[model samples]
Target: MPSLVDYIIYTFIKIDDSLNKILEEYDRPLRARVFKPKLSDSEVITMELIGELFGIDSTVGIWRYFNKHWT
Candidate 1:
């Protein structure tokens, strides 16, 4: 069946993208993996961007959570 989406898709498919050039970016280190589905450096920074996203900022509070979950 004919549709607007099909029309747009076909138009872009005929366009040439060979003229475009892109630069490479630096690779992220493995130690930055902190959450499920693990994220990149920019993503990891965003995760902690929100104030108190982890809650209870101090070291003691963090240690308490670690102790409860670890031993």
Candidate 2:
């Protein structure tokens, strides 16, 4: 069996793929400004999901957790 981390990663990948597909089918502008962001929408969403899964309440806590584990 795959480890818990592996399962989490797999689920995240599936969710991201689905999100991308939906976005592609839409006509709405994804970004608010002309300038592009460093991180993709899917990446930001994955981080948000991680924050929720880990019970992080604040944006700062989410950043800290992501930086600690991802960076």
Candidate 3:
């Protein structure tokens, strides 16, 4: 069985790979807005997916869990 950390890492890898493939298919560069985000889109998606998979409902709950435990 995979541990929590394993799941998180796998999710991130899959998301990042998918995003890269998508960008390549469209021939578009990843452009940031006026302000860059602290985390990448893949990271954010991984966090959200993990949170939902584990039944974490609130954004703050997800952030706190990852911040305290994963970080």
Candidate 4:
């Protein structure tokens, strides 16, 4: 079985690839000129996926888990 870190990396890559393809086809801007987000959409999605896989049901709990462990 793949390790947790490996799974996270794989998931992020797949999500990013899919998002890029959709963006290319749609040709739409995801953000404005200023106020960039701290994390990319793919990163956020990957984090949430990881949280769900590990049974983190609350948004606050997911944030706390990643903040404490990922950082």
Candidate 5:
């Protein structure tokens, strides 16, 4: 059986792939005044999911956790 981390990664990949497909189908035009974000929408969403899974209640907590554990 795959490890828990491996399973989590696989799930995240599937979610990200689905999100990309949906975005491609939508094909929404970008606002003229809005600049491109450094992080992709999928990436931000993945981080949010990770935070929730780990019971992180605040954005700052999420950032701190990621900084310590992810990076």
Candidate 6:
């Protein structure tokens, strides 16, 4: 069986190869904590999904939607 990282990497790449192309984009971005703790990738991905589905393009817009609906 694959390790957690292996599975996560495989699943992510399989789901969207463009995601891999964009992975380097976040390495230098500011990562702030929220909700008294850090949210997992699943939570972030959920917000991304909703945002993309609604044709939201900006990161700030996605965050605003998540804050409004997920609160």
Best by lDDT: 4
TM-score leaderboard ranking: 4, 3, 2, 5, 6, 1
Candidates 4 and 5 compared: the better one by lDDT is 4
Compared with the true structure, the alpha-carbon lDDT of candidate 6 equals: 0.64
Instruction: Judging by lDDT, tell me the better candidate of 1 and 5.
Output: 5
The superposed Cα distance between candidate 2 and the true structure at residue 25, in angstroms, equals 2.4
Q: Give per-residue CA lDDT, model 6, range 1-71, as digits (tens).
A: 99754754565555455544566678653345554446655456656765776799988999997688657
lDDT of 4 by residue, 29-59 (tens): 7665578889998999899989999999988
Candidate 5, after superposition: displacement of residue 62 in Å? 0.9
Q: Report model 5's TM-score to 2 decimal places.
A: 0.70
TM-score of each: 0.25, 0.75, 0.80, 0.88, 0.70, 0.45
**Residue ranges of candidate 3 with Cα displaced over 4 Å:** 27-31
Worst 10 residues of 3 by lDDT: 23-32
Worst 10 residues of 5 by lDDT: 25-34
Per-residue lDDT for 9 in model 1? 41
Q: Clashes in candidate 3: how many?
A: 0
The lDDT of each candidate is 0.40, 0.81, 0.87, 0.90, 0.75, 0.64
Poorest 10 consecutive residues by lDDT, candidate 6:
28-37
Clashes of 2: 0
Per-residue CA lDDT of model 5 for 1-71, tens digit only, reads 99867865886798789887777766573323367877666667777787888899888898788779867
Tens-place lDDT per residue, model 1, 1-71, is: 75744643443333212111211232543354456553333332322332134575755665465457535
| Steric clash pairs (candidate 3) | none
Q: How many Å off is the CA of 9 in candidate 4?
A: 0.3
